[model samples]
Target chain A: MIHLLKQQWWKYTAVIILLYVLIGGMLVPLGPSALSLYPVSIPSDTSVNFTITGYHTHFEDAKDLQVWFKPTTGTQFYKADSIVPIINSTVRIVFHMPKSNLANKHSENYDLVVNDSIDGTLTTVYAMTVAAGTGESSPAVTPANQPEVNQLKFKAFAFPFQKILFQTIRNTFFHVPMWFAMMFLLIFSLVYSILYLRTGKIEYDILASQAVATALLFGVLGLATGMMWATYTWGQPWPNDPKLNGAAIGVIIYLAYIVLRGSLSDEIQKAKISAVYNVFAIVIFTLFIFVIPRLKTVDSLHPGNGGNPAFGKYDMDNHLRMFFYPAVIGWALLGFWIMSVRVRIKLLQHKKSLL
Target chain B: MRKLLCFIIVIFTVLYTSAQSAEPIPSLMESNLKIYVVVGVLTIIFSGIIIFLLSMDRRLKKLEEGH
Candidate 1:
């Protein structure tokens, strides 16, 4: 065991460090409630009373609360002078919406930000849409001069800080990287498979098999992180979205590749047949992940479908792109490192077998 | 060998078909299904690769020993 550890120490060490970065370092800093959005909806031209509830787990102590509201498309947030001090574990703030502001056609929605001083928790500014009322009459009080149409810059909070440290956004880092790594490894596996078929060499077969094995590892990690992200974002452990279904089908095809490899007894024949099948599997997997998800008929809650924007103006930003792109490269490199080690091990064993 | 291959195919096909047929999911159910399938597929693929690698190692050992 020590000999084995020493021989593969670098690979093992790199994997351990990566795991630590994934779970202990990155995930812990990213809080559990990091990606949550509060829902708020109020009717226009009416006064409504609403309470803000904050659940406390770590610090049960009460804290000073400040609520901020700004127009969704504007910069200036109306800060409430009244600070609600929490008596019990839960803090509730009641606020009334002005009827006149609701009547103005200038604003359609408001962004709400709730802050706790003691715990230092800043809730994502929840956006509330204004519903039309029966009385469509203009506001009773009209300002003498309305600002120029273009100059009426309603400054709102600068776009929320680009990214959070939690596992909630782990999909962008972990899951996406896994898919990229898998794709990279699969490309090599396909090449090796084709070479094995052409040359009838066991070496190419071993390389192809090792590459698949490495790709599978990345695929699994991607899936696990995706599940975690979905649970927090979509409020469920699993969703039958088209993008998700395509992912499942893609994995199944690769798994079928493995099962095919296992069933063959003759080494030479197994290598030949599995190689052909793997090539087909890669094609099918690509179609499932890319082509199937793009079809407009398929209803999916994933971004980039069903009227949802792709990772365009909404999904990702510069900050996320910074860490995310590096993550892809790092993960792919790690996958290649593992594949090389496995291929070496296979070659050693094959040499011993021939002896 | 052929029989084992056929059996594995049969099991995988059954699973794939079952997953496909279980659809028309409600909004909440749809979200949950997406998570489950994505994670499930990935888990299967990863574990399957590890198992295949270990089996290959064993086969190499057997061949080495002239078994």
Candidate 2:
């Protein structure tokens, strides 16, 4: 039993990591979201009533919740006269503002800050705008937040699915990692092909074949998840886009290679021909993904395309990099485990055929 | 049956076009926590698949060992 534990440690670890990614990724609550601010247009000198709505507000137990209206250009917030909660998600507030200098600024933008003991604080930019507010009469009142609530904290393990992505961002944990794992499998498969070419070994050929099969499995999985994500984000399942087409072509090339291998009966002849094809396929697939996609005249809808903002930019703010990195490793390990099992089965079959 | 199929197609086309034009459907995220239910169901299906594959792998090994 102990020996078994030592031997299959990686398999267990892969399962555990995947479980962590799956359960923790889904269950963790999103940070407090500020949805809208009302009466965005207001007169500067006069006090005005404003309401802000939020999602997952946790107002029932928010022991000492604080709300502030901060201007984007100013050092101080237009201190609220009173912040009254209508419900868990909705709040109505009144604010007294300093007189305005229409010459100084046409419009004043205020950020909405909400701090709660349990849920922490969230600041939404451009929460409200004052048409005529910037005066000397109003004194700046600094907010006093509770020590516990003053600091921002996040759950130990959670995925931050951003606003643009909404729920669809969860697909990143599955889709992107599957592709990365597929690449990992294919890289080894490419290496095994090279080794097979050099040594003329049947074992290397078997390893290459199994790795390609497993990698292609992940490629298909990635494509499906990607399509699901696109249906949500891009509003279509199959966009006539280059990257998607390139990826599909890469899959087809390998699918043809698979068919080519199965058709041949001569072992040595088969190994030599398929090894050459596998090497060519990997190179062509890499070029399709890396080189041609970049050079294409068509603007790719994929993130990080045509000088648009990419994954990393959003990743930092949302802490997507944290969960996404582990997801990649976990999926890669699972893919390798699947490939290894297939390779072992192939070896078994080979042995039986020899006997 | 033809009428029913045509009705279904019209409904699908309408739904698809509406989704295409309107960028956000935040109510899906805001109300009833339906997204979590969806993600949960997907996770369960995926787990079932992995489990089935693992069992198949074990059986294959058992066959290999037996003969």
Candidate 3:
């Protein structure tokens, strides 16, 4: 087995690395999360005031602040140039929805674009539907009582899914896979930890340590992707949402695992203590990430509970599944592959030291 | 060996069955490319590690037996 491994190591490693670069790096970011339209209802025929709110970020201080609005269905665009200087990182521009526009038989679609001219940042693009007949002065009953409104009623629905997808490309690429990879690694670590505790084998301890290290790498990546995803999807880098909170807690527990490993000096003692802690981390991670969030009543941006369906149903269509499953398997297998290599390297280093 | 072969067979069967399902095949261009890249990178890295480990394991075992 050793001879075979030694002779063919380079070939196997090269093949694995090449396959990953080809599939994971290049193939997954090609989906449509670019443009979306949301419909908001207004009292029929009444001219409603529309307000466009821009979040204050570092670029908000830029000099050229331009807000543009155009009816998605109509040629006319209402422009408010050089609006009030953004204060406290937020600028709200109000415009009157023309009553005449609402008087038509169908609901009108309005697209709002906020641009920071100084930084050349196109802050946000959103479409709102002004429900027909909701405007002041209800029009006389026509063929259809009112036209369809394309504006989003709920603020959640107003989110620019497409733009978020583009901006947080690495979020999907790095964050989610990290979590999946982390889970697989952690589980492997936990199993080895258990075996070490039962059989008192130094080899199992080594496996446990390597698994924890691999899992931690995944955890960090998951956190980075999640933070970016939160920024684009929720319009903030971090929100106090339940799901976000849960993920934070879970990561902290894993960090504690690393700390525990570092605190002990004796190799045998370190292994045993760390093994115990790893088991605890697994339990806590499962509870915090999986159980607690599901039980909590607080609203979450994550899908499955709290009025949001997970990306699994809407985002994970047939095409996505094809690459997504492969991505998961490929990543998990790769994680194991790395862990094994690290173990071997450590074992060799130990032997060399003895020599 | 039998267990390894069985595992491979099971995986192949699962893949085959999943492929036969009614869902339409998704276009590569239409899917999220970002996810694909991340997964791909992770796979390569992990696979490389596994190969290296296997090699080391063999060498270590031989050294131990010689002793």
Candidate 4:
């Protein structure tokens, strides 16, 4: 395994796979999504016209269209009376309000679900609120005449379209891989540090330092890309997010490890001190980046944090996984390649200094 | 190295001019399409990689000169 690490073929593999990831991630279209619904509230027992906007939906091409208003609590669904296709991505739907209270509550939120032969089922949650009126306080009536939805038409290969994350979703291939690369590089540094401590070898020390330096570069790239992604999605470049802050602290701690090595003059002393510091640094860095952000008490705007469902659960469909896994491996291999080159340079410098 | 620098500078100039042409400055970044934002991010990452590679090249040059 160690011998293969010094080989040249993996670097070419990294380049080829990264090129694939870049092309595939960018070129793939997004699946249809119901973006939003207008007039979010309505009183019971009245027919209301609602405008539902969709993203990448083929309303014009859809042969059979069905719409439904399902309450948040019950299995009962109120079928739309009529639907008019406004445009390729917009539709005007009319739903008759239920005569009785749906959940026996004062008001109940309904999810706007639009389905068609070409676009499958698209839903916008909490889209419309139906307030109770002077009517019989009975169980919500399930419309018996609900039309059976046609066979869903899924595009051959596409990323799942999500609200607020449209084309910028392509950044996942470029931005997310940076952090994975950084993590792997740091792990390499940590392992080399342990090897140096055990063997008392200056070459292992050089490997450790070069890995950290490469990791720092990837860490900075990760931060820059993450900030760019956060700006458009979260409406701010820097929000008070736990994961963001943790990442920043982890980088700073690693920076201090570099500073600690620079302050020491003796080669053996520098290696010994920095290797010990590297161990502590990696531990604290892991705690900051991985542990603190995931604590139940802390809330983070990042996915999979603060009780929100992660991209793995829904957003990372089969199409995304096809590209995402390769991206992680390619970026990480590139990082290792860079670190190996640096180690070679350091070894040459050491030999020249001895001569 | 000089050729690489010139190439990067030209790319930046093209991006800047295209971004500033005919539309309000913020709308290009703020548009619902958001494809430009992706382009911006890709540019930043590619630039970072280029810079890192260039620095490595510089270090190798220095070592060769010493030899």
Which numbered prediction scores highest in TM-score against the true structure?
4
Chain A TM value for model 1: 0.65
Order of models, best TM-score first: 4, 2, 1, 3
Candidate 1 C-alpha lDDT tens digits along B1-67 = 4576677779988976776677643332236223343344345445555555566566566656766
Clashing residue pairs in candidate 2, if any? Answer: A44-A132, A44-A133, A70-A111
When summed lDDT is taken over every stretch of 10 residues in candidate 1 chain A, the lowest stretch is: A150-159
lDDT of 1 at B48: 56
lDDT of each: 0.61, 0.71, 0.57, 0.83
Better of 1 and 4 by TM-score: 4
lDDT of 1 at A250: 78
Least accurate 10 contiguous residues by lDDT in model 2 chain A: A140-149
lDDT of each residue in A150-265, candidate 2, tens digit only: 67644333455256565555666777887899899899889989999999989899888888988877877777767656655566779987789889998898898889989999
Minimum summed lDDT over a 10-residue window in model 1 chain B is located at B25-34
Of models 1 and 2, which has the larger TM-score?
A: 2
Candidate 4 matches the true fold with a TM-score of: 0.85
Evaluate model 1: give its TM-score: 0.59
Writing each residue's lDDT as its tens digit, candidate 3 over A1-355 gives: 2243235555466456547634544444332121322224454444344444333232256565555555665545566423564452455554445445554556666666554533233323336765544325533322222222223212211221244354234334345666788899899889989999998988788888877776766666566556645544566768877767777788788788778878888888998999998888899888877776666475777766565666677654454454456556656666666666667666666666568
Q: Which stretches of candidate 3 lie over 4 Å from their true place?
A: A1-163, A166-171, A305-307, A352-355, B1-67
For residue A149, model 1's alpha carbon misses the true position, in angstroms, by 15
- Per-model DockQ against the true two-chain complex: 0.08, 0.13, 0.04, 0.66
Task: Output the better candidate (1/2) by DockQ.
Answer: 2
